[model samples]
Target: MPSIPLPGFQPPESIQEVFLNPGGFHFGTTDTRIVTLLGSCVSITLWHPRLRVGGMCHFMLPSRGVIPEGAGYDGRYGDEAMKLFLGHIMRIGAEPEAFQAKLFGGANMFADMAQRCEINVGERNIEMGLLQLERYGIPLVAKHLGGESHRKLMFDVWSGDVWLKSEQGRKPR
Candidate 1:
């Protein structure tokens, strides 16, 4: 896909950023600004307005079961990452109901991989995230999922808000 410039993205030479790799997660106050690139992966951002605390996780697979042996439950899986993310934010005094969630990064980027897997990882991720959120009764405020372009995700920890950009420069609904 040809890259389309995003409206809010800073020029390459401009802003400094903290980039989160797959399987990694971070939580903090509004002082944090984190970024990640995703394709056929999912990232969830949680924030509590009252507490002014927030978190973000970049997960590769829907579950740990799909990974090979010796791979312990980790942030790369949606289930495990959700647990860890919620746990961290809770430690700082965030309640389940107080959290507002925004989901991003579930794009079917490769045709070959999609054909081989027979299931879209992106779609599975969306389902898993929604199910888990429903289980906790946490409200999902927004989402950008299931497309053909990779996403660039950004989280502002203090406000617990996130923004998304893709090669197509499509904004969230």
Candidate 2:
């Protein structure tokens, strides 16, 4: 018996989909797509084409310094997230120096956040993303940051591509 191909049907590409919520990350060598929704949060994607491997992280806070009693330390902090990201990259037998990085999210979802809290979490996240990459000597290829709109980001680890879509009528400040 011969199986006939269905009309207008095509096999799906080999892609692993992962959704990174706040305080999460994913690392893989296969063709992977990582998605995240951000409002005053940030996500970073690192890819090493030579090794055909990559990783992504979504973090909500800047650091764990002076964490409240109930707010235990976690990857939700930018500093912690970076440590975890780099650790995993190294564990996977890849050096951080070889990774090409792309940064996304980091929108100031609140207008009065700075005045009230004396800081903008989104901007802080973006800053941490850039600073950490530079500190680790990773090549930051692209970045889409510092906006007032929420962002929906899709990152392709295999190709080192990040697709960013912002909420309607919102612009970077």
Candidate 3:
């Protein structure tokens, strides 16, 4: 196995590793894990009770329709990304009724620009995420959202333990 370095933090050595960069999602059972950084964007985790399987998505945009044509696929969009993440979990045998969600991020990092379009995107992302989860009948188990600082998240696929690291604080679930 190759060694991967994590800046300012120790990296774990394992056969299976999953890294979720900004605007990305990864779902699978592996000895490795999933990791991501969140700013104004929102990260949502959905896990199945029976299968112990789940996925995480970091989305930056509130909706996809606002993006212009030919912009390609923006995984950062909440609506688009959430659908894709949920669909992937479902494909792997996760039932909607059996899954619960955990959401984080949507920081008001751009507070100075509150009057600008950039400031409201974060709030919109959170709103759309909650609405979408409710629409799908999935209950939200926990959340650590809306603040002024970014976050670093690590999700252990094998154990389903989510570690949220942020300047504000850490919430483990």
Alpha-carbon runs more than 4 Å astray in model 2? 1-12, 66-73, 168-170
- Model 3 scores a TM of 0.79
Q: Best candidate, TM-score-wise?
A: 2
**lDDT, candidate 1, 1-173, per-residue tens:** 22244454323433235688988887766456778999878888888876766778888888866656776558888988888877776677667878898888777777578799797787788788877788787899988887788888877655454776688733323
Put down candidate 2 lDDT per residue, 35-114, tens digits, no spaces: 88888888888888777678888999888687577763477888777887888787877888888888887887886868
TM-score on alpha carbons, each prediction: 0.80, 0.82, 0.79
How many clashing pairs per prediction, in order?
A: 2, 0, 2
**Model 1 per-residue lDDT at 146:** 77
After superposition, the stretches of candidate 3 with alpha carbons farther than 4 Å from their true spots are 1-15, 30-32, 66-73, 116-118, 169-173
